[model samples]
Each structure stands twice: as structure tokens, then as C-alpha cells.
Target: MDIELLRDYCLAKPAVEECFPFGPDNLVFKVNGKMFLLASIDQQPLQFNVKCDPEKAIELREQYPSILPGYHMNKKLWNTVIIDGSLSTQQLKEFIDHSYELVIKGKKK
Candidate 1:
């Protein structure tokens, strides 16, 4: 999916909002005021970083080589998923949903 589609998908979820808290190029998607997804709007290789369980993170990276430890995030707590590769759009949506739920379940800052 492209940027707008990805943005719309996350924004459609409960209590979600979009912002550029890091800068103009970086787009952040948050739920309940906590960010769960982020990407560089100006970057290539369309992918969005998301929070993930540490064990599941390694499993995903192994299962889908396209999935990697998150860029600029704690490797143990997050992952950067390459959305346009290996996974289908449906699977990608599920991953996004999972990330949203995981963040909401995390300790609030």
C-alpha cells in the first residue's frame, strides 16, 4: 500500500491521530496519544516502524526477511516492517492492528 492508504488505515482505528512530532519528513501514527507507527514520508522503500514484542520481533524478522528490528528504536521493543514486501495487504493490516494494540497495552509515558 502507498502512504495515503497506510495513513487512512491507521487513522480509521480507534482514537488514532497523525502528526509529525519528529519533523516534517517523519510521519507518526498514534493511538490514545501514544505513537505506534512511524515512517519517513520522504524516504523510499515504503515501510513503517512499529512496536512489537521482543520474541515475536525476532520470529517475524526470521519469518519475513523484509521485517527487521526497528530503525532508531530499541531493538527489543520495536520493529520496522517493510510493508510492500512479502506480506499481503491483509497481513500488513493485521500487523498494524497488533502494533496499535501492543502500544495501547504498554505503560503510558
Candidate 2:
């Protein structure tokens, strides 16, 4: 999906807010004041980093070349997903949901 679609998807989730705290190039999505997703607005091929279960993150990286260790993030807990048509929109949305859920879960702790 494109940036607008991704933005809409994340905003559709409960209590999600988009911000440019890291600067205009980096768009961040937060839930309950915790960041769960970060995308570079100026980047080509459209990529976003999402929080993920550590083991699952490895699995996804192994499964898809487009999924890699999060850029400038804790690689063990996040995955940078490239939106290059390799993944379906549903799959991307699921990733966003997982990221949001992970943030919410973290906030509870």
C-alpha cells in the first residue's frame, strides 16, 4: 500500500495518532503514547517499521526479503517491511495491528 493508505489504516485503529516527532521525513504512529510504527515519508518503494514478536520477526525476515531488521530500531523487536507488492494489503494491515497490539501490551507492563 501507499503512504496515504498506510496512514489511514493505522489511524483506523483505536487511539492511534500520527506524528513527526523524529522530523518531517519520519512519520510515526503511536498508541497510548507508545510508538509502534515508523515510516520514512520520503523513502522510495514505501517501507515502514513495525514492532513484532522477536522470534516471529526472525521468521518473517527469513521468509521475505522485503522484511528486514528495523532501520535504526531495536532489530530484535521490530521489522522493516517494504511495500513493494510482495505482501498483500491484508497482510500489511495485520502487521500494523500486531504492532499496535504489541505497543498496547508493552504499556500494560
Candidate 3:
């Protein structure tokens, strides 16, 4: 999995939108106007940062070297996943779902 994979996954979701809200090289994926996924096109190893539950983020980091605190996001609430095939596609998809849900849950009320 890489930037293209991330893009495809996000775009496949209903009402999802892709943007460069952070910059040209950085891609942002949103659903219902809320961000759930973000990745840098130029970054090496094709890493992506996703909104995630703080506890889950820590667990993932402990379980896989590919998962770490997001570079530009809240360290306690997000994670950076290296797209190196370390995690199974199913697992990646699940993480994406969790990330999306977490972001949606955090929307202004």
C-alpha cells in the first residue's frame, strides 16, 4: 500500500472528498467534510497519517514498527502508518475505518 492505495480507499467511501488542504504534495481525504486520512506524495517509504483513537494508536505502535505517532497530527490521537505491507490489507482497511469513525466522532457538536 502507498499513496495511491490510500487515495483509492478513501475515494471509495461514500461522500468522500480528496484535497490538498495542507499543501500540494500532501493529500487529504475527507468524508462529510471531515478529514480521516492524510498522506504525503513525496515522502519516502510512502507513509500516511490517520486519525485514530489514542489507545489504539499506542497499541498499533507497539505491535508494528510501521505505526507511529503522526508527524504533524496530535501524537496522542493519531498515527503514522508506513505502507510497506507489514499489515495485512484487511487490517489496513480496519484501521482506515477506525480512523474515519474517530474523526467523525470528533466533529463539532
Of candidates 3 and 2, the better by TM-score? 2
RMSD in order of candidates: 1.7, 0.7, 1.5
Q: State the lDDT of candidate 2 residue by residue for 1-109, as single tens digits.
A: 8999999989988988989998999999999999999999899999999999999999999999999999999999999999999999999998989999989998999
lDDT of 3 by residue, 1-109 (tens): 7667778888898778999988899988888788888888998878888888788789889999989899888899889888787888888888889988777777745
**Shift in Å, residue 32, candidate 2:** 0.5
Per-residue CA lDDT of candidate 1, range 1-109, in tens? 8889899999999899999999999999988888999987877778889888889999998999889989999899888888656789897888898899898877454
Error of 2 at 89 (Å): 0.6
Candidates 1 and 3, the one with greater TM-score: 1
Q: Which ranges of candidate 3 are over 4 A from the true structure? A: none
**Model 3: worst 10 consecutive residues (lDDT sum):** 100-109
- In angstroms, how far off is 67's CA in candidate 2? 0.1
- Which has the higher lDDT value, candidate number 1 or candidate number 3? 1
lDDT at position 102, candidate 3: 76
**Candidate-wise lDDT, in order:** 0.87, 0.94, 0.85
How many clashing residue pairs, candidate 3? 0
